[model samples]
Target: MNATSGAPVNAPAELHDRPIGDLIRDARNLSAAEVEKVLSYQREHGVRFGEAAITLGLASPDDVLNALAQQFHYPLANAERRLASPELVTLLQPFSVQAEAIRAVRSQVTMRLGQGEAARQALAVISPASGDGKTYFAANLAVSLAQLGGRTLIIDADLRGPRQHEVFKVSNSAGLSTLLSGRAENQLIQTVEGVSGLFVLPCGPIPPNPLELIERPAFALLIRELSTKFDHVVIDTAAASLGADACVVAARCGAALVLTRKNENKISALQDLVASLAGSSAQLLGAVVNEF
Candidate 1:
């Protein structure tokens, strides 16, 4: 419930101040009698209404969460009943604590990417090594940006090891690789259903030469074209310490953020990756220490 602090200012005043129980009742997820049971349990156990509802088996956890989301005017995950995981919390559970943190990152990214005469419209999310959580951060950040009512696009440019298509639940049959290979048309982009102003471009099939594809001038053109069409373009790239693909993508995008998992990534490798990005003509937008 503390996550309500990040609610959009344009949200209704009542939504901002409504009690959790009232919101749950308005959502109609529980009958009046069930709500009364929850309230009685909450009063006796000093637990939140959502928790009480779940504890008493009146509603599943996902149901309670969806009710809370409806109460707070946050976007729910999918119409298919799939719950959002902690990794993609921003899309499904926009009023969660994790989503709030992602919104904070979005705020910093917006200001940094929008600065200067020629704004840096594209951002490549990179990490020093694999398992550093760059893709997770990039996906959630894109969702957060889209929640602001601006057109936002997230591209899975990490050719060899793609995840955006899976995360966004879109097809990866044709995307960046196919687009760059001239095998796919502009149809490579897919709208994230249930999420307004949010789109995804998956990595498609893994190419034999990811570096060659990324280094081509066509890659820059693709980024430029995407930038013009979307208010924000967030690209997820490979680990810099693993290969030169991320650096190449970051160089083309012109703005990059390094993601590192606490107590997992090597400091020396991070230093070397940052130095490499600096040499690649990519502006470093500060590093993020993700606890995930």
Candidate 2:
């Protein structure tokens, strides 16, 4: 699905409309004889087919969940296939409290981003320091935004210590840094597997002059181009203290969300960063405090 347009997702055939029994059978590779047993047990116990399958150990919980996800059009990763962190609450447990909170943040951000202007393309996720859950929050926010249906692109601009490639389980052999450095010509952005309408521009290989690259006029051109191509853009940046990278990124995007973590971030640093943003061209959308 192109999040930039109203196009429908490139979803698989409508399997969710099928009966749970059929979904369960296909999901678990159950034979006709095994399906009969599940049906028999379901009737005998007055339980759903999925429940009966689970009770009989014919299908694991993950199997049931996989079938259910198909039935609901919910984007879910197969437990056997996911390589990202469990803390990716938005994708792993979309209904969990954490995911819900991310959705809430998305709502707030979306409400603010409604516009007919080009600045609507990207939202910079920034912080005063590292290890403040900026990448975590940025990754989840991108996923949550993608869940809204259209395409959402999260650009890993953290050239100093990039990690969105790992968070989204994508190859970082050629990405943002490489593209900015004039080396990448193809596969600059990869469509995330399993998550529809989500794309990633990984930080690519670490560059020698990260700030110099971001400061180049090409960076501004890139932001403008990306804004036009994607429905929503989320750019993750190095901490403000690392340099003016975050500030520059936020300025280019025209909006930013500042993040802080409990016990790790110095209040004075956050105050300084916020103050700095207040004086910049970018609008300070809001601040989020991440605990644990």
Worst 10 residues of 1 by lDDT: 1-10
Q: How many backbone clashes does candidate 2 have?
A: 2
Instruction: Give the Cα lDDT of each candidate.
Output: 0.81, 0.86
Clashing pairs in 2: 3-150, 3-151
> What's the TM for model 1?
0.76
lDDT of 2: 0.86
List ranges where model 1 is wrong by over 4 Å: 1-73, 78-81, 84-86, 115-120
Off by over 4 Å in 2: 1-12, 43-46, 115-119
**lDDT: worst 10-residue window of model 2:** 1-10
Best by TM-score: 2
